[model samples]
Target: MLFELMRKREGVYNEDRKERTENRPIEEATVPEYLVFPLAMHIGAPAEPTVEKGDKVKVGTLIAEKAGFISANVHSSISGEVIDISDQPTIKGIAPCITIKNDYKDLEEPPLYSEDEELSVDQMIEIIEKAGVVGMGGATFPTSVKLSPPAEKTIDTLIINGAECEPYSTADHRLMVDHAKELIDGVRILVDILSVGTVHIALESNTHDSVEEMKKILDKVDHINIVELETIYPQGSEKNLIKKLTDREVPAGGLPVDVHTVVVSVATTLAIYEAIRSRRPTVKRITTITGEPIQEPKNLLVRVGTPINHLIEECQGFRSKPGKVIHGGPMMGIPIKSGRIPVTKGTSVITFLEKEEAVRSERTPCIQCAECLNVCPVSLQPILISQAYENGDIEEAERLGAMDCIDCGNCSYICPSKIPLLDNIRSAKKEIRARQEEQ
Candidate 1:
């Protein structure tokens, strides 16, 4: 596995800072006056709203039900009255949200997990599905579906990804530091569910303290081992992590399971533990709100539906005029038009770039420098794919393996001509998928 990654490695890519440097302890975000719950926080179809406007609700109340087996449930993280069931701005655009006015009473229905017992795989899956635990690392894939791999596929490895490779995103790092026990328990739960004998937890070597801390908590578990990885961007992506750790490259259009493994993130693991241990549904998550424009850089324990404005204020507001506000890290994160977007299970970092940092240069034509191919974590030729996309040749883009592009933006960062390689390929991939669906 190290053979491929070892040959070429850039310690830190452009457009990203290696260290977030805040290192502050987790702080509780102030409850917003209103909480907006987007019904479609997860990967699949949007959840169906269960509450109507004006319905009185408490914390942990089911606000939406799962629309399909691949969807996760949505709950009210605040005790308030349902103000409206209308389209609200989200990181993914305007989605239907259950708007609530916070009363600040925070009363709960009841404790969902009363006792702990040896749970069978079926029982474990049931609790996980009911808890609405999706991947908190930003993918937001339904965890239950990941746990329920096809029976024909023999899952041999379960890897816990703690590599906070995305620059300006250390939500996972804080989770490992403050909630190591929770992360470990989540890994153990996954161990039992997958029936995998050995578990490898991968963290960037920069986060050495996290490895020591997690090892101390999981020292007795012989089946678990810690794997330190290079602090490279996109190291946390499932396919990339699988290859770097296990020496298995998922074929084009293949999944981690094709290599008999499943890779999960540190935040996702902690979410799993919380859902099973406390029976707490996926109602909230810790997010990193940082950048050059913010007054204070913080890792906050924010409720699911809390607005970004609340967090910005909690962080002491902006220090300078904001140039661009990204929904995640600068590399793969999307730029948001506004800050009113509510927090969701997939929320990671709210990155604000200064005017200079957000500057977009003119694209001069591809220089064919092959720099993109060298820096691409997936080793795909981004220039060819971008060319294919620019020509509107979906077949050429498909032939160039556009779908294999991880959208890491490394190519765009490396291009001297300032071509938008990742964005172009991304558009082409979307069209390719739509064509496939049409067929």
Candidate 2:
């Protein structure tokens, strides 16, 4: 009976999703006026700037060099003059950025590889590492590091995340439909590199067309399977996707690799394809500009370091006062104070929410309704962890499994009393990690 109830809920969710997709058309945007590429977009050590102010750089020219194993290379998105290489606002609050004044010259850098050349797995890994390619789906973890796991841990399955379950984010959806070939090539590259036994492309039932398109392409190929996931909030999460697809719970305080699996985002896979096959670094990404305030919602292939303001203007600027400007999707993205920040490799969307939609009410006491727990894909007790945070009991929170929270924001979404469950849980987790580091 319980299984039947769950199936009924999933069916209703799928119906609502079909209606939404039917109403929206996948639209694309033309090139923007200017792109502000930043130096330190990825997580590791900031790339060292190679070009100075006033230097002319061509598209695909290396502007910044990787400084460490965990870092990624930075490149010029357009053939332009280096207007300035100094501190500038970035999507992650503020950071040093390289301002390139586009000359619109359309000059190209020498091709990194010839079309006829075929690279071995080692060569591909070397190219990807040097290109500074990282996970483009917001995690920004160095892709090479993930590809080079320890020898003892045998990898059998490589899961490509196409779920894209976040609300108001369509970059992945459009990419799957538009760049199907590149995505598939990327999957093949990963399969070869990791020597994985099988490849699975997991997409939510919400994106049936994307699945259909992918299936049409994969029909000719072997060993690649498409798994349709239940349309649920946070279905795109690495842990949650692993659970729903394989029925394998990633052990608490463990990673996906611990269970003999590796998950990569569709965007990251595409980036890998470009890096290995084309010999290009990750210097730009597709960002969706959409919201109530946005004049026209569309997907743009923005160069890394393009200022947020340039994108807003390209989208015909906002129609009214925007209550908040978020760099990624609404559910898991961080809200930026200003659009002056430049785009980065990890940025996938620029969302502007109106006042009514953006404002959050004050938090209230938990009513012990257990809605959060029920919806939580990780099965963590958000109410208890949040209570521990309020009372400043770090150890209690840790003991109650606060650290296992995936920070997917589903608990916060399901809470009726407006409790900031994920936020508090994140705080508690941070404190716990800090204490461990200090000790």
Candidate 3:
């Protein structure tokens, strides 16, 4: 039975998923005059540029090489001349960026790897690494590294996270509905590589179309189960999804591989399929441009280096003045200081909140309500961790498991006192990491 007795999931908040773009088809965004590519888009070491200023590049051109084993490669999304390479404003902060002047040729570089012969597991992985496939669910971890777990860890399960639970984000949902066959093909490739015993496509109940569409495709297929989860915030998290499906808890500071499982998002899976089948690199992705301030809320198939301002313009500008512009969903997205920041691999949604909705109420003292505790998926006490950090107790915060936080921002959302609980915990986690490096 696909619907087995699941462990009663706890500490998850039922959120109103403002999936405004669910019914909208994925529209291709217009290419802008200039595109900016950031080197440090993924986790681990930043990619090193392979091309310099005045060099010509085409779509799928390798502009940057992986700096380390954990980093992914970077490719040009548009045919252009490298105009400048210097520090520029990004969603994170000032970082080394590659600015390209679009030639408007719409030319594409030929496939680097041939797909004429059947691909071996190693060859498949190599292709993905070259394509710069990373987790598209906001964590931008190199997909090549994720697929290749340590030899000791026995991976028994592969879970495709279709639970686009973050409010106002429907990129994954649309991918499933429109491209179910491609997703299943990607899953098969992953299964061959990981040699997992079982495969499960996990989606929230809110994604009815996705579930039904996938089921239709997988009806003849075997060994792949479709599991439905409650529509809860952070239900798409790797740990929580693992717990609900396999009754396995990834220990604090551990990964899904620790529990003998692997989770790949819908967008990343599709990228893998494209990389292997057509030898296409991760040059573009589907990003949801939405919010009440947006004149047109729709899902756009956007190039990697397209600026946020271009996307805003594509949406017919704002219906009203936008008070806050975020890189992803409101719950856990980073606030974009400028629209100049280009869309990275992990960007799934660009949320524009009106002035009224973006207004922050004054933060009051914590009331010991413990609502944060009740909603924390990882069971960490945000109150204690935040307090420890406030008192300059970095070690204390570490001991309280500040590093285990997924930064889901549920604590701050549930806090009745309006405390910036998530911010403090994030600060504490950062300090803990810095001190550890010092040691």
Leading candidate by lDDT: 3
Query: In model 1, which regions exceed 4 Å deviation?
Result: 1-22, 116-118
Name the candidate that leads on TM-score.
3
Pairs in steric clash, model 1: none
Let me know the TM-score candidate 3 reaches against the reference structure: 0.96
Winner on TM-score between 2 and 3 is 3
lDDT of 1 at 436: 93
- For candidate 3, write residues 199-304 as lDDT tens digits: 9999988878887887777745558998888777888888889988999999988999999999999999999998987789999999999998899898999999
Q: Per-prediction TM-score, please?
A: 0.95, 0.89, 0.96
lDDT of 2 by residue, 1-439 (tens): 0011122211112112122222344454444556676767887788898999989999888888888877878888788888787777776546677778788886888767766788887888878887778888888888988898888878888999988776677888878887888899899989999988778898877777877777777745558988888776677889977877777879988988898899999999999988887777776677778877888667878777677887787777878989888888666787898667877889887777888777787777778887777877777888999999999999999999998886777677667788988789988998999899899
**All candidates' lDDT scores?**
0.83, 0.78, 0.88
Clashing pairs in 3: none
Task: Give the lDDT of residue 315 in candidate 1.
Answer: 90
lDDT of model 2 at residue 142?
84
